[model samples]
Each structure stands twice: as structure tokens, then as C-alpha cells.
Target: MKTRIKFSKEGNLRFVGHLDMMRYFQKANRRAELPVAYSEGFHPHQIMSFAAPLGMGLEGKAEYFDLRITEEGAATLHSAEAAERLNREMAEGIRILSFLRLPDDSPNCMSIVHAADYEILFRAVAPEDKIAGQFVDGSAYRSLTGDEERSLRAAVDELLQRKEIPVQKTGKKGNLRELDLRPMIHALRCEDNRLRCTVAQGSEANLKPELLLSALFSLDTARPFAAMPRRVVRTELYDSAGKTLESYGTIF
Candidate 1:
């Protein structure tokens, strides 16, 4: 039997890397005594796989992982009770949101992740600093003209209109590959201090949202962009059709 685990990472746990998180769960499941299946070998490891690895400093709202379980009365272990058992053993920043029993034919979580929604919160930059700074250094932040605000809104539209936005993508072997980032950015929006965006993610094609954001920041030709995002929070994961991956499974 296979089980899908949905959880969230925040606070200090956001600093934990992917490999460490996997090890944490290994020890966690062992302590919980969940019947997680292990591969047959002298150094057998738990049969677990993650949907997508969250970046070190980012927070994940809905993250998923898959694990196989012993079929001995697996039905009884497929519900909130199982999640509760794991939760008791979890540290403060990680919470097990759901324990789903996927359909027998369903693919693993990693292969099915095609898109992700995210919210990027940026630090405040003074309005005068936003204005090329030469003519506006003495101005107050709130006193900016309507034209200045309108330009801020138009910057996002102009970025998406570019024919090609090239970025250097590093390969696993440390090779550099120049790739166009336009098509992978499915959606982008800039509010006062936040950006809500959706971008491609999968083996077929992947574009980190930060790349798209960097391109957007570059649109401000007059002023040097003063701040990077203060925080990035992954809101959800989806399939190619933009359907939430969790929607494809059944509650255990």
C-alpha cells in the first residue's frame, strides 16, 4: 500500500534542507512506529519520495511526499489516526496536514508536479528611491505623483511582453546553459509589496519564480532595484491542467 503525506514547513524548519528533512522523517516514522516499508538490502532505506524540494529559505504551505507501507491491514493505517501518530513525533515547525491513500495506478508525486503557486513578499523601498533618484531624492514616499504609481503597475506588463528573457541555468555537472524564461512564467502579479505568481515546475520544463521576478525587477531602468524579496511562501502545487495535486487523491 502507498500513502501520500501532505505537510507544511515554517519557522526554523524553513532553514532545513531537503536531505535533512528526509532524514528527519525517517527517524520520525520509526519513532511513530508506522508500518513504512523499507527496501530489502543490508543498508535498506525507507521507500519515500518527495514531490518537490522547497528552497532553503522559503516556506511551504502544501508539500507532499510518498511512502510505501506494509499491506498487513494497511486499510486501518490510512486515515487521520496515521497522521496523528506522525504529528505527535514531529517538531514544532512541521505539521502533517493529510494522510491520503492514492489510487493504485496513480503516479508518484514528483513526476506529477507541473506547476506551483507562490507569494513573494518584498521589503519596502521608498518611493523616491523608486524614481530614478536624481530628481526625486528629496521627495516623500507618499507624495509620489499618480504617474509614478502607474509606471510601477506597467512594469509587470512590460516584462511579460518581452520576446525572450534569457537566464543562465546551471546543470548538475556545473555546466551553464542559457535558457529563455518567457513561456514558463504562467502568471505574474505585483501588488504593493507582494508578488503572486505561478510558474512551470517538472522534469519536462522548470522555471524558478525568482528568475521571473529578477526579470521584472530589471524593468525599472531608471532606479536600481533596492530590495529583494523578504520572504517566499509556496501556496500550492498543481498538475498540468492547473488542478491541485491533492484533488487527485482520496482521503484515507
Candidate 2:
């Protein structure tokens, strides 16, 4: 049986890296004596996979994972009662929101996840006293200048229509790869010192939330700043059809 678990990370736990979190969950399953199936190999391991790994220093309300169990009864271990038992043993800043059964044919959360929505908070700039103020001012200016706003919108639209938007993927060679960011960008809105956007999913065209924000910032050349203090909170995850993928409300 396959079980999907939704959870949140908060407090100091937001600093924990992906691999460490995986280890933490593995230990939790062991302590609970879950009849989780192990891979058939020399070095067998629990069959578990996260929907998406959270970036360091960012807090979010939604996160999820899918786990395969050897015995059907082990699926019952994800119940609310079992979740509470697991939470009691889990360290502070980590909370299990819910666990539910999924259809055997259901796509893996990681592969089916097509878009992620996030809200980022940053420092205010220009004449605005608050970050929100800057966002409002920028919006007003854009609205007042019809031609400029139209041109900017057109450029973004054209970019979205492309088959691929090449970006540098940092790896052993620091090579350039053609990733279609168009499918990844569902929407982008700015308010005050916060920028909210949704980008497409899948490993092939995944866009870092920060990279999207950087592109938006570069759109305006007149406003110059060395850096910005930004914090991101993932709001939701969606599929290609724009359906909510899973609830990770407790993770943030």
C-alpha cells in the first residue's frame, strides 16, 4: 500500500537540509516499528520519496511525500492516532499534518507536482516606507504607463510561449541547459515587499523561486540595489491541471 504524508517544518527545523530530514523520518519509522518495506538489494532501505525538497532557511505550510509499505496493515500507521504518536517522538519544529491512502495508479507526488506557489518577503526600496508600499507604487506606475506596461507584459508573455528558456544548471561542469520555464511560471504578482509566484514542476524545468524573483527585479533597470533580504514560504503545490497536489499546511 502507498501512503501519502503531509507535514510542515517550522522554527529552527527550517534550517535542516533535505538529506537530514530524510534520515529523521527513517528513524521515526524505525522507532514506530512500522512494517515498511525495504528495497530488495544488498543494502536495503525504506521506500520513501519526498514530493519536493524544501530549500534551506525558507518556511512553508505545505509539503508532502509518498511511502510504500510492505504490509497493508502498515498503512494504518499513518492514521491520526499514529501521527500523534509519531509527533510525540519527533523533535520540535516538525509536525505531521495528515496521512491518507492513495490509489495504486496515482502518480508519484514528485513527478505529478507541476507547479508550486510561494510568497516571498523582502526589504522595501525606493520611496515606499514598507515593502508593501514599494509594491503598490510599482503597480501604480505600471498601470499609469499603458504602453510600457503593455510592452513588459508582452515580453513576459512571449517568454512563456517559448518551448524552452535556457538556464545555467550548476553541476560538475556548470553547464547551460534549455529548461522550459514557461510551463513552470503559472502566475507572478508583487505586493509591497512581497512577491508571490507559481512555477511549473518536474525536475526538467523546475525554477528556483529565487531565480524567478531575480528575473522580475532585473526587469526594472532604474531601481538599483546590491542585495535584498528575502524569506520564502511555499503556499501550495499543484498538478498540471491546476489541482492542489497535497496538503503540507503543518510543515510551515
Highest lDDT against the true fold, candidate: 1
- Please give, for residues 1-252, the per-residue lDDT of candidate 1 as tens digits: 878899999766888999999999999999999998889989999999999998887888899999888888485676788899999999887999988888878889999999999876543355434432221113222223456446655876787788888888779999999999888888887665456888988888887766766777777731333253256779899988777777766776
Reference-based lDDT, residue 188, model 2: 70
Error of 1 at 241 (Å): 2.4
Best by TM-score: 1
The TM-score of predicted model 1 comes to 0.84
lDDT of 2: 0.65
* Residue ranges of candidate 2 with Cα displaced over 4 Å: 75-78, 123-172, 177-183, 221-226, 247-252
Please, what is the TM-score per model? Answer: 0.84, 0.73
lDDT of 2 by residue, 149-182 (tens): 3544554455556565555555658766544455
